[model samples]
Target: MGFFQRFFKKVEEVNNQEAAASELESELYVESPEEEAMNLWVEIAQNILVNSVRATGNSVDRAFVLVEMREQPSFDIFYQKDGDLVMWYELEDPAIKERIENELLPQAPSVASAVNGNFAEIGQPEITFAQLQFEWATKAWFSHIIREDDAHAKLAKDEVLHNWFNNLSTEIKTQQLDSDTKLSWYP
Candidate 1:
């Protein structure tokens, strides 16, 4: 091949390689912001359930499995079956406590009674990322509970829940940070 033709071919190959590399990098690094938020939500849900269960001095009814809600942020529901009553509890934003009390409770007295009577209520439960996996499984129960039907509302609520869970999880994890490890290793 002629020198100029060979040189041009090599340059074109190099450009193609660079373009492929850029596309691969973008694919590897690009993640949906919603997905990241959902992950944070999962961590938070696990923590709250753990802390709440611990505070109550009762282990989760392991006979039941954790299920995530579809079309929602990181929230899960647990259920146990009895002769005539099916018990259900959802782990979600702690702020749902207020909503449950003010809105849902009055409308769904049975659900309210189940929540108030059977489950122990712990305010502002704190948990660590490591501890999270031990409490709740990664799979969540999918469902729509009213406002979730609206796309905009669901997105807004999911975002809010994600932020709330992230903040709380970070705070709890930070508190558990090993200050002694740094000092002792350095010393």
Candidate 2:
């Protein structure tokens, strides 16, 4: 009887240990705040991108979402979700293009050097690389309200990106950048 009692106790202890280990493992896979933020932005980008592709009445082109982080400044850019590399200028946002020219192009060299490593140092970093790679990546997505043509149907699902951006908390974003971390996103 005594031996059986000791055996049962040991079994219980082992089960408890296994349960704790499982809990810890699950916690390890949980997304960090930065990852969560990236995901949210990615989702928004995807929604817009899908709608934009429909505007062309064309097939999928190459698409991506890139997050560029540096010490002084950071940027989150969304490429059209379709990854076929089609010429998709129908949805290009001119205001965004202008802002990129004024703000991002000038500081691109430093950012490029940091992100691309030695390749950026070969010569003056091509601001066009940054423009084409990051800022211009999102040109494919057109807002429903902003469209001038009747080709695309107005969908209520399209998020006004500027309004979405305004709603993001700057404090939380700054905190996320504190870690020596880089974050990007996809579905």
Per-residue error (Å), model 1, residue 40: 1.7
lDDT per residue (tens digit) for residues 1-187 in model 1: 2334445555666587844433433333333444443444444444444543343233332112122233221332222211111122343344544443353323323322222222223221211111122222223322112222334333343353344344433333433222221100000
Q: How far in Å is the alpha carbon of 144 misplaced in model 1?
A: 7.3
Q: How far is candidate 1 from the true structure (C-alpha RMSD, Å)?
A: 20.9
TM, every model: 0.24, 0.22
Cα lDDT of candidate 1 equals 0.31
Residue pair clashes in candidate 2: 61-82, 61-83, 61-84, 61-85, 62-83, 62-84, 62-85, 63-83
State model 2's lDDT: 0.32
lDDT of 2 by residue, 27-87 (tens): 3344544444334434443543443333333333322222222332233333332322222
Where is model 2 more than 4 Å wrong at Cα?
Answer: 1-30, 59-187
**After superposition on all CA atoms, what RMSD does each candidate show versus the true structure?**
20.9, 20.4
